[model samples]
Target: MTLRIATAGKGGVGKTTFTAMMTRALVEKGARPALVVDADPNANLNYYLGVKYDATVSDLRESLKRDQPPSGMSKPDFTALKISEILSENDGYDLLAMGRPEGPGCYCFVNEVLRAAMTRLASKYAVLLVDNEAGLEHLSRRTTDDVDNLFIVSDSSIVALRAAARIKLLSASLELKVKNISLVLNRIKSDAEREAAISSARDIVGKDTQIAAVIPEIAEIGGMLSSGSNVFLLKDFPREILEPLVSPHET
Candidate 1:
């Protein structure tokens, strides 16, 4: 079974960094060949994962409007083939980026094709980690629905917590098939802040949601992000912060 894990948070809240760390943790735990989907329009998950991608699903969709596949090939087959070509394969995982959102034109047909292709590709992996946008448009589109675990990340700020609460509410309103939804309080500065953030999160996100992980604010991670360094290079990468998120998927 593919363990579908998604990370959602407002911009600048460290969701991408968390996704990268979680990917490393999953690989270290023997979860090989995971599928990492960059569901954000401003795609950078590949950079954090230390991989480069030339194309994206949205890029293919746009091209399909103007170009045609080889002679005698159907559109669906062509789309699937293009999507497969864009997948950036790596040692422990592969990255698929969903580039910029749709433009003025209708994309119902292309979206359906992309969704189907993504579903087919996901089945070949043991884990699927999606780094989603702030609004979670990917989930709303059903591009990556039926999530096994949804991690709503937030910094130690009231505004960020409010955003997290809204994301949780939106997930419920959309009726997304998420088996477990948790709040990941990230980049905490101190024990007091972590405690306060957890308490505030519990109150805001409600008791139904679990406080899955509280990650401390590590200067090394911040430096790496600022310097565009690979996630694996961060010494003492907080694997403990990800254990809670990874253990459940372990066999």
Candidate 2:
């Protein structure tokens, strides 16, 4: 079964960073056939995964809007052809960028097709990790909910914790849903500081929200994110967080 892990938090909470690293960690631990869905319109997960994106779902949406048909072809056939051309993959995992956002009331036929294809694509993977947007609009609109472990990451601020709480509540209300929601306190300094965020998050999220792990507030770790590379590959960080995620049998 595919383990669907998702990250949710306001922008700059390091959701993208966590998503990339967790994927890398799983891969490094001999987890193959993983998939990472860069669902945010910001589209920065590629940087973390070291992926150079060549196309996006928006490009396909544009093609569908054009609806260009060959001399004798029908519109339906033309649409099918465009859908077949959009999917792409790199070495470690298949990456899909949702691209920049659309207006409030944009047409969505092509988007629906892409969502359907993405669903089928996800089914073929061993693990699927989604880097969510600040408000989790994709999870609501695209029916991409039901994560086995949904991580709500945040920085030092209590405001972020509040936002995570709100997101957890919003996700629960959605008919499309996350099965298990958790939190990862990011950019934590001393053990005491981490303990504070954990305690605050736990208080807000209550018993259902698991504290998955804490990402240290290390200067070099921040530097790695600056260049858009994953720090989870570092021996020490993975040992602290990712290794514990593996089941005993899987080890």
Highest TM-score: give the candidate number: 1
Q: For model 2, where is the 10-residue window of minimal lDDT?
A: 242-251
Residue pairs clashing, model 2: 146-177
| Count of residue pairs whose backbone atoms collide, per candidate | 0, 1
Best by lDDT: 1
Q: Write the per-residue lDDT of candidate 1 for residues 27-133, one digit (tens) a residue.
A: 88788778998877788898888889988888776587888989999877787778879889888988888777666445465457546744777788888888887
Residues 1-251, model 2: lDDT tens digits: 77777778888888887787777777777666677777776688887777676777767666667666988997756765564455456665777776765666552653464455446556777787778778756556754565667778888687888888887777777755566666788888898998787778778767566787888875655667566555554544645576565332431
**Which pairs clash inside model 1?**
none
TM-score of each: 0.89, 0.82
Evaluate model 1: give its TM-score.
Answer: 0.89
Model 1: weakest 10-residue lDDT segment is 105-114
